[model samples]
Target chain A: MQALFGQLLVGLINGSFYALLSLGLAIIFGLLNVVNFAHGAQYMMGAFAAWMAATYLGVGYFWALLLVPAAMGLVGVAVERLLLRRLYGLDNLYGLLLTFGLTLIAEGLFHQAYGNSGSTYPVPAALRGGVNLGFMYLPLYRAWVVVVSVVVCAASWFVIERTKLGAYLRAGTENPRLLQAFGVNVPLMFTLTYGFGVALAAFAGVMAAPVYQVTPLMGSSVIMVVFAVVVIGGMGSIAGSIFTGIGIGLVEGLTRYLYPEASSVVVFVVMALVLLVRPAGLFGRQR
Target chain B: MSRIPRVACCLAALLAAPTLAADKVSDGVVKIGVLTDMTGYYSDLAGPGSVLAARMAIEDFGGKVLGKPVQLVSADHQLKADVASNTARKWFDQEQVDVIADLVSSSTAGAVMPVAAEKKRITLLSGPGTTAFTGEKCTAYNVHWTYNNWALANGTGREVVRQGGDTWYFVTADYIFGRSLEEDTTKVVKAAGGKVLGFARHPSPGTTDFSSYLLQAQSSGAKIVGLANAGADTVNCIKQANEFGVTPKQSLAGLLVFITDVHSLGLDTAKGMYLTTAFYWDMNDETRKWSERFFAKHKKMPTMVQAGVYSSVMHYLKAVQAAGTDDADAVMAKMKATPVNDFFAKNARIGPDGLLRHDMYLARVKAPGASKKPWDYYEIVKTIPAAEAFPTVEQQACPLAKSASPAVMKK
Candidate 1:
């Protein structure tokens, strides 16, 4: 039972990364009609940004937590305005390919700069150890990650679902020309939405630095799984991506508990099952 | 650099090296391509660091061999076997790269050695650990430099079993390299009269979360947990093991570890762990000198793989100088005839099977306070003799070594 509870905690922590990353992907895909393939690279960059802060500038985790995302958001906006904005009228596949190319270039540059064995970002002093829950040791940092992830995910969903800004954003997504006639700057909305989505990815990467080693490939490693989560949840549904991400994370943890060998592929297996059961996804709108 | 005229150099090299097409490169130059994982998991151990070591070797060797300027180049294999095989092909076919050095991961090395042999070019592997390199996959133009699975398993696994932490459970990265590591270490455990409890194989190379895997290993009651992975995989496993409180009870046998891994993992999590390695930067004055140069460039102390690159490239250049020819077979013959005593390996010998015999160290990670300074990680507990560290020639039964003496052949 102790072992089981421990696995559950692991599941929740793993779920947080999946949920956060998928949420960002869902938002960008919904608004831009372009799959942000560089989400993973942006995530990895976030960690590297934090690592650079701590290593060179003596910036600690708290400052990195607040500052790294904002910095990466600027990077995100630059990418959108300079490159992605040009590809807006092309096929969505072109956007995927371009972002994918950007991912490769970014990852390659990072690899040259910081060879891939990765460095440790020490868990901040405040969240150092864990709580003995009588059944198992519950790591304080992991619990914090889960709590913070839920709050961020909820905040993102609430803003997108209930705010007037969200209404303009949604209207722009539906028909940019129509939204523009209402004096809305649809292009600015697209740019900010893309930046906001990228910031979320950076936030997740910052959170993951201490949990997972900060390797350039960390984003590529998890991005595939996040895509699987998005596909299973529905490509454009905010709640769907969030819920599915955590659910898959738990299922993976359970698989690890039940059979360690199957843990890696269990998420994909669940994806296949979901695809078979609901071709449109659990929350996807009927095409 | 080369005193010879361009046209004359092409005809001369082409006559002596028929394997390379005459039109490849006309200049009297020896191009050595350092193929390694430049952008992936194994990069830290052998990427730019390995390239720097190769360059240092060439520079130290007077930058010329047989009146030909030595040119060094490199490419990132990205940890893909197909990518490595293609790069090796292109280097051999078009680039006129005479020798390739530092094939890091076993998969990349395995994919490349056959290509090198087929092309009649020499390859020096500085980081691969699969025993198949010295046995089934042995090639006339290939040398498994520094260490392999046999050395790591015996050096670390035997020491762990000897310490009475015998019963073993393996948390392996599921793949060719990881499987081979676990299999080799398992043999060492059983040979030491230790019991093999069970194992849990995790995702290969890319796995980040290891908590569930650690929980299973912790609950299994194994006295010692063997980590059959390298680079980032190994570092993450050890770190997560500490977080789950698994390390306090059962010792971890780091089946494959490098000094850089300890630097990333930090001594707090890696302390007291037993590992086997070919070189540690602080091993001696010679090692320290070379490592300092590497550190100046890489901003971190060298891993054994990087050190191995220096020694192997140095030796390869020496063999070329001795033979007075860049012919693959001739250089290989001179290499086999020579003995290696360098900053990394002490009196190391290349076997007929293409495996190099060198002293392997049994070391324990230093506690936080015990460490003298940054990168001072290991306390060498024992030096496993070269003879016992690698598999015997007879046991390997490499076709190339079938006629050679079973004993260590010293020049």
Candidate 2:
């Protein structure tokens, strides 16, 4: 039972990253209708930005948490306006290919600058140690990740569902022609939405800095797993993505306790099972 | 008029004579290509450092061979076998590269071997993936200059089990490296009267969570969890193992660990873990001095792979000078006969299967607070001799080993 609880904690931590990255991916897909292949690279950039700010500039984690996401969002805006905007009217496959090329270029540049060896990012002073939970020792930084990710996911959902700007954005996504007819600058909305989604990815990257090293290819490693989560959750619903991310994380954790060999492959197996059960996904509407 | 024409002819002959003499003295420059994974998994081991090591060796040898300047060029194979093979072909055909060094990744090296054979170029393989390249597919041109799975497992697993940590469970990365490492280590464990309770093979490259693997190991009741993986996979497995609280109960033995991995993991998580390697930066005064020099230039400690690159290149240059030709077979014969002396090793030699016979060490990670400085993580426990650390020639299943008369080879 103690081992089981420990696995759950591990699951939650992984789930937090899943929720953050998948939510961002879903948002970009919803607004821009382009699967941003460079999403992982942007996430890696965020971690690198945080590490550089801290190591080179002596900035703390708190400042990096705010600044890294903003910097990445700015980069996203530049990419959307300068590069992605050109492919807007073309086939969506073009966007995917273009973004993949961008991913390669971005990853290559980072590799040129940093090489392949990863740099360490220490956990913050306040959250450096673990707390004894009787059943298992829980690292404070991991708990913090879960709390922050949940809060961020909820806030994003609230803004998208409740706010007037979010309503306009959703309207723009559904019927850009009609939204533009109603004098809502749909193109600008699409650009901002893409920027916001990238920023969310960056935010997760910053959160992940202390847990993992800041590497040139760090994003690519985890991005596929996040994509798997996105697929299992269904690309259609935001809330579904959040729930599925956490749920899968827990299931993965439980498998670690009960069946360790399956832990690494369990998620993909679940993805395949989900596809068989509901091809569109658990939360996706049938096209 | 005849006397004036004779003087003009004499002057033209004098100019042509000097040009012909100069051409005889210097036959252009010798170009060597350093091909390896530049941006993928093995990049830390064989990327920029491998190229830099080769260049440094060339520079140390005065940057000239056969009275001509030497040039070093490199290409990123990106860990793809086909790409590596194709790159080697281009380097040989288009660039006229005489030798190719540091082919990292076993599959990539396997792919590049035939290219080197066909081209008849001297291939000093310091970082090629597996021992099998030298053992089974022993090419006359290819010189396996460093350690392999059998050596690594022999040094770590056999020694560890013999020292009393007997029962084993493997958390293996599901790939060539992991599979080979586990297979080698398991043989050592069983030979030492230890039993493998069970093993779990995790997917390579993309695995982020390792809780399940750790849990299974924990449940198996094995005394040691042998991690037969490298790079981010190894680091992640160890990190998640700590999270799952499996380490204190079951000992974790890393089949392969490098300085870079230690730096990323930090002393806190990695403390008390035992691992084996051919090189450690703080192993000795000589090693420390050499590593300090390298760190000053690259801002990173030299891994065994990087050091292997330096040693292999230096030895290859010497062989080329000795043989008086750049032919693969000639250079390889000279390399085998010659002794390798470097910062990380002394008196190393190429074995029958092309393995570099050198000492391996068992080291334990120190606590973060125990470290006197940053990068001070390991404490050496044992120095494994070259003969014991590597498989015997008889045990080497290479066709070359089988065909060769062991009587004359015994030194």
Candidate 3:
């Protein structure tokens, strides 16, 4: 029973990352209508930025935690204004292709500069140990990641659902022409929305730096899993994405405990099952 | 009449001299093709370092064999099997490359094998890929040098388990390398009276979060969490494990950890961890000298793959010198017969299965406080003999083994 509960906790933690990445993807897609293929690369850049700030620049986790996301967010804003903005007037497929190319370029440049070997980033001193939870020993950092990710996801949900700026952003997304007539700068909102989404991804990367090595190709592999999460959650619903991400993570963790061999394939299998049963998704609206 | 005859002879000699010069140039040049990962995951292992190592070996060998000067031409396999095979075909057909070296990926090596066999050119592997290239897929033209998953797992897992770190949990990368290493190491662990408590398979390359997996390991009650992964994955596991404090109480064993990983992790996070490897920069005096020279030129210590390239190329040249022909079968025969002597080994041999038998070592990570120099990471705790490091002849599953006599098999 303790084992089962332990696996469930594991699943939830994984779900947190899935939720965060998928949420970021959904937010970007909802506003920009551009599937950012470079999201993973940008995510990697965020982690590396954090690692570099800490290692080379002598910045602590506190500063890196704040500045890394902002830096990547600025890069995202620049990318959108300089490059992605031009593709907006064209077919959405062009935007997707552009982002894909950007991902390739980003990954290629990093690989060329750093090689394929990984660079390390240590956890902060405060979160460098585990707490005995009676049922199972919980790593303090892991618990912190879960707590932080949940809080961030909830905060994002609240801001998007409850705030005036979020209402304006949503309005701009739904009817940019009308929003423009209402004396609102819809283009700037779109750019900022994309930047915010990228910032979220970068935020996840910073959170992940101490957990995973900062590698050039780190973003490419996880992006596929995030895409699968997006597909399962239905790109239209943010709440649905959050729930599905965490749900899948728990399922994956349980699978690891019960049948280790099938843990990896379990997510895809669930995805297929979801596709077969609902066609759209659990919370996704029908086309 | 004499002047006319002399002028006609001079013109004839000048025209013939052009053909003679062409013949001499062709005879003196020996082309070697380096097919490796130039732009993918394993590029660091075999890209620039491999090319440099091969060049150094050629220069050290006096750059000539059979009175012919050596020339190297490299191609980016791009970590793709089809691309690697295509490159090998091009090298053999168009350039007439006498040898091909540094095939990085297992699938890439597998693709190049048939082409090497057909072309009758020597192919030397210095990177981790297919053990089958030496085992079931053994070809007369191929030599599986340096380390493989089996050697790595057996050396590390067996030693750790025997030393009472028995209960095992694995945080494996979800890929071929991870799966194979975990599967191979599990056998060693079980054989040593250890149980694999559980395993967590994470996505390859870009998986940044191991919190969930480490939590599972922490809960497993396993004494050791074996990382049957390499490169970015291993480093990430180590970093996260430190954050989670998975080490010290529950030991961490890296099935394949390179010196580069140690440098990245620093001795603080990596301390007290055990790992197995085929080569270390500070293993011996000769190795130190070679490493010093390599580091001076490249600004980084040479990886096992880089060392493997040097060994493979040096041995291949020796085999070619002995065989007197670049024919795959002839060269392979000479290679198997002649003992390999290089920085990595005293006298290695190409076994019947085409696997190069050599010593493997088990080392423990030194604490950050214990380090006396930069890049000094591991302290050698055990040296697995060449015969014990690898699977024996009887355990070998090669087709060639079936034909060998029972007496030969016993030896």
Top candidate (DockQ): 1
- Model 3, A118-214: lDDT tens digits are 6877778998777877666677877998999999999998998899987887776677899899999888888888888899999988987877778
Candidate 3 stretches with Cα past 4 Å from truth are: A272-287, B1-29, B62-64, B67-69, B75-98, B105-107, B129-133, B169-220, B401-411
* Worst ten in a row by lDDT for model 3 chain B: B19-28
Best by lDDT: 1
Instruction: Write the candidate numbers in order of decreasing DockQ.
Output: 1, 3, 2
lDDT of 3 by residue, B288-325 (tens): 99989998987789888899888888887777677665
Give per-residue CA lDDT, model 1, range B1-411, as digits (tens): 465687788888778785463323235788899999877788777788899999999999999877779999999897889999999999989888889999998889999999999999988989889898889779888999978988899998988888898899999988888899999999989999999898989887789888888877888889998999888888988887777677778778889998878887878878888889898888888988888988897898988898899899999988888877787877888898888988888777888889899998999999999988888899999989999999987788688787655453444
lDDT of 2 by residue, B1-411 (tens): 899889999998997985554332123667788888778867876788888888888998999877777899999987788998899999888877888888877777888888888888867777744657666677767777767888778777877897788999998887776788888888889988999998888876666556656766877779899998887778877776665567777788988887778877778878887777778888889888877877888878888888888888888888778866555666677787777887767888876667778888888889887899867878888898888877676676677756757652552
lDDT of 3: 0.81
Candidates in order, interface RMSD in Å: 1.4, 3.1, 2.8
lDDT of candidate 2 over A1-287, digit per residue (tens): 77678678878888989899999998888778888888899899999999999989999999999998998999999999999999989999999999899999988998888776677787789876667787666667888999999999999999988999889877876878998999988888888988998999999999988777678888998888778888888874687788888998899888776876677688899999999999878787665
Docking class of 1: medium
Query: After superposition, which runs of candidate 2 have C-alpha atoms over 4 Å from their true positions?
Result: A1-13, A56-67, A123-148, A185-188, A228-236, A243-287, B1-30, B93-95, B282-293, B366-378, B405-411
Which of the two candidates, 1 or 3, achieves a greater lDDT against the reference? Answer: 1
